[model samples]
Target chain A: MSRHLLALRQATIGDASESIAAVLDQLAREDPVGAQWLRSLDWAELRRLAAERALAQAAKTLACPLQKQYANASQYGTESGDPPKGTCIGVLVGGDTGYGSSVQLGVAIDGQALSFFWNVASQEAASGTLERMRETVRQAFREQTRILMLELLSEDGEVQREQDAAGRTVLRATLVVGGGAR
Target chain B: MTTKGTITIIAIPKSAEVEVHIDLPEVPECTRIAARMQAVLACLGAPLEDIQDLPAPRQRQGVSHAMRKRVRGGT
Candidate 1:
């Protein structure tokens, strides 16, 4: 997998309100810690924060899975055949809450498979937890693959609950792959 | 808006590569910047599959606070 960082600066001169809000939104998404603190402040304080420094909301995309897999295919009998059955993609969504003080992390998939995993943490300064975030991402991928419609080998469908709220636990649903149209 | 201070970094595992994206100026542009990163990923063989628009999160105010306000009758 290859990773790259793309950053752009956006500054709105005349009406600082719109520009400030936009920057705060991006910051909340990128830096949850900083966002948490920002959330507690009133508009005046928020504007002050905006005026102090330009917001930098950075996000990363994990890619290039196939190219990396082609080499190890010999071991898995993945040679010269059906051209990689599926695509395994992963992403990490994070940001500051509009309040500009709290940070939130959400991880989900593309299809009907909607899995939003989030955690609210303090703004120990505007930043993301790299290691923790990566681990969750890997888990998401694993969950997606196991639940793939066709990958079921036995009657082993399980719903794992990571957290519970109001007597309801957040479910990590798996995709069932591999039945060839059944 | 400028992205000077913030640095966007992508870490590729297999080839052990790291791509850096820097935003110039003071403020950062979110959408356009995201698009540029998508372009870089497209080149690195990670084209976006499809964009799924999820519902926005709704803010939840405390019910107890609302109840208290109702009882006080605009105190």
Candidate 2:
């Protein structure tokens, strides 16, 4: 399993309005310790805390389950000097498929089976065609995970295709989030 | 709007392997995120062979909380 960090830099989450208060009250009812930890923060910090639960869901969905032990003791500031807040999560990036090591995590689309990517050389495909394919995959993936990635769609993002020596391909997405520190 | 950060998500053959940024910009709706995650899992074809409600966690000896929320991890 590989580890990835979801870093946040002074993103504004707004004031502790009544709605947010209600949410915190509910959180307290469920997890008082967490609520206490969250309540101490201003809206900016609260917004950062919100990522905690969301990330847990994300990690769980990826089969690379989120472990609290991996959480950094983010009590210090960093080079960016903005608290350097981040959550380290274990990611299952590669695995053995018997024939050899494969990054094909065995996922399907629209409940349809996918052909082995190694058999189809991405280099042979036309540049535009490959880009289209990659876009199609990205769209399908976004459509499938719209809920978890709700806010990310609005941000300009890019997708790249990565292939190892074994021709194993991994589609990587980099989504930039606009700061909402209102 | 200023760019605050970037989330790197990897998508594998499993259409659902895509990593979510979960960068809390404004709203951090836990229920919404959980619902979406559950949907993503279903989309990934996680076998749903069984449907049993999780048992309530046992209360700690002297703790005053019951932790009634059914969330898998209160992270």
Candidate 3:
């Protein structure tokens, strides 16, 4: 149970971007057809799609924040004739759990296989546990996304997207949790 | 002395000993989040994992007190 409280002032933009992209790719492969379908939807429309699907609960959990305080104090006094005094100091701080979709991707629904992927991802994004989280990761194809989708595919094709059986499209959302407490 | 790490465990009564690691950077906050995560895990009756707090400075008590007050008020 390792933990870190980092006030990272834009120190890990690359990591965040990479993670965001990785998550998108994961969602895309997990449900290819659904990802294709979601790719066809507009970004705003996809955001609205999540909104329509009880987004508040997911939003709350993913937006966890935290704060802490540290203090080191000492006392100084003398018994002999002299003025008496004491010293005290403290540090106060605040930060977030770094969990939320910083960036979003549009997903398109192409077939049933893709549909299951989207449904699962959306469920996980909104209310997913470690088990679901693990399954989602397992289902996503990371390397293929970078080499197959980014290097080869056109800009219009690559997006943070996923789809479901009902032709329902959803965009992949980025969720950031602070690292260091590993 | 150079920065060092710490381990703080907050356990539930009649339950297993839950251990959390508090990296030197965010010891207290790691402690706080670990505590919250522990509660969340317990409520769900789920197995726990070592949750890491992002690297940063220690949290300030004054702000934390204010935030706690706000949380209490909100609830």
Candidate 4:
């Protein structure tokens, strides 16, 4: 069975507001045609253009079938219980700040099945825990376990917990793969 | 008056994959922008299946807090 993990690094814009302004300015100075095009857009038109760019960027980054499979599996739901064994790939993205900062991870083993987890937390703790989650994925890649499990861990090596709430860190780890082993 | 805010788009990749988050000025503007974004996603070959509006950080905290309480209360 083949298992793969594709990690898309966070974009390096420090502040979205500032970055957008700067990018627009740069476009205007360096590419007058593009700047003029942008300037001609209504507010709604500009937003549509932005959305198109973001989608195109993500699509380019996830060109591989495995990555696409994993992404599909992560977002959709499947029947309850373990997935039939075969080749399974999981894709997860997590971070403390920005849009969709809540911890969301999805694994797709078979073609149509998906298992997902969402955890909401304070910004400070969410950021730290997301780093640990990435490490966990790396470890899973190294170990090649048939079943993968991960816990949100703090910097000090203890299981992480939401600061303002009473609950242990939640990590629901299960992989589903349909069809015969590959 | 023109309303101003940010919008984030997350692509979900099934038949098509895109999620949108809007913080625009007015409801009408938000609706118009969202429809336009959907069109863009379609042109990009990944139409949107779901769209979500992300709340501001402070509002998110409140929602999360409430959710945690509900979970704890076993509702």
Q: After superposing candidate 1, which stretches have Cα over 4 Å from the reference?
A: A1-101, A108-131, A147-151, A155-182, B1-75
Q: How much lDDT does candidate 4 score?
A: 0.29
Model 4 misplaced regions, further than 4 Å: A1-182, B10-18, B51-75
**Clash-forming residue pairs, model 4:** A110-A177, A110-A178, B10-B19, B12-B17, B12-B18, B13-B17
**lDDT against true structure, model 2:** 0.31
Considering only chain B, report the TM-score of each candidate against the true chain B.
0.34, 0.29, 0.31, 0.50
Is model 2 an incorrect, acceptable, medium or high docking prediction?
Answer: incorrect
* Residue-wise C-alpha lDDT for candidate 4, range B15-60, written one tens digit per residue: 1222234444344444444443333222222223343334433233
Count of clashes, each model: 57, 2, 37, 6
True contacts kept of 2: 0.25
Interface RMSD of each: 21.3, 12.9, 19.0, 21.4
Q: Which tens-of-lDDT digit does each residue in A64-138 have in candidate 4?
A: 121222232232233222223322233344443553433433332222111223232345242465455533432
| Candidate 2 lDDT tens digits, B1-75 | 643322323333433333332233333332233333333223222211122333433344332222112222110
* Collision pairs in model 2: A12-A181, A107-B14
Winner on TM-score (1 vs 4): 4
Clashes of 2: 2
| Native-to-model Cα distance after best TM-score fit, residue A45 in candidate 1, in Å | 43
Q: Write the per-residue lDDT of candidate 3 for residues A19-133, one digit (tens) a residue.
A: 2223334445544433343345343332222222212222233342211112111111112211111111111111222423211211212211111111111222334342332
Error of 3 at A105 (Å): 28
lDDT of each: 0.27, 0.31, 0.25, 0.29
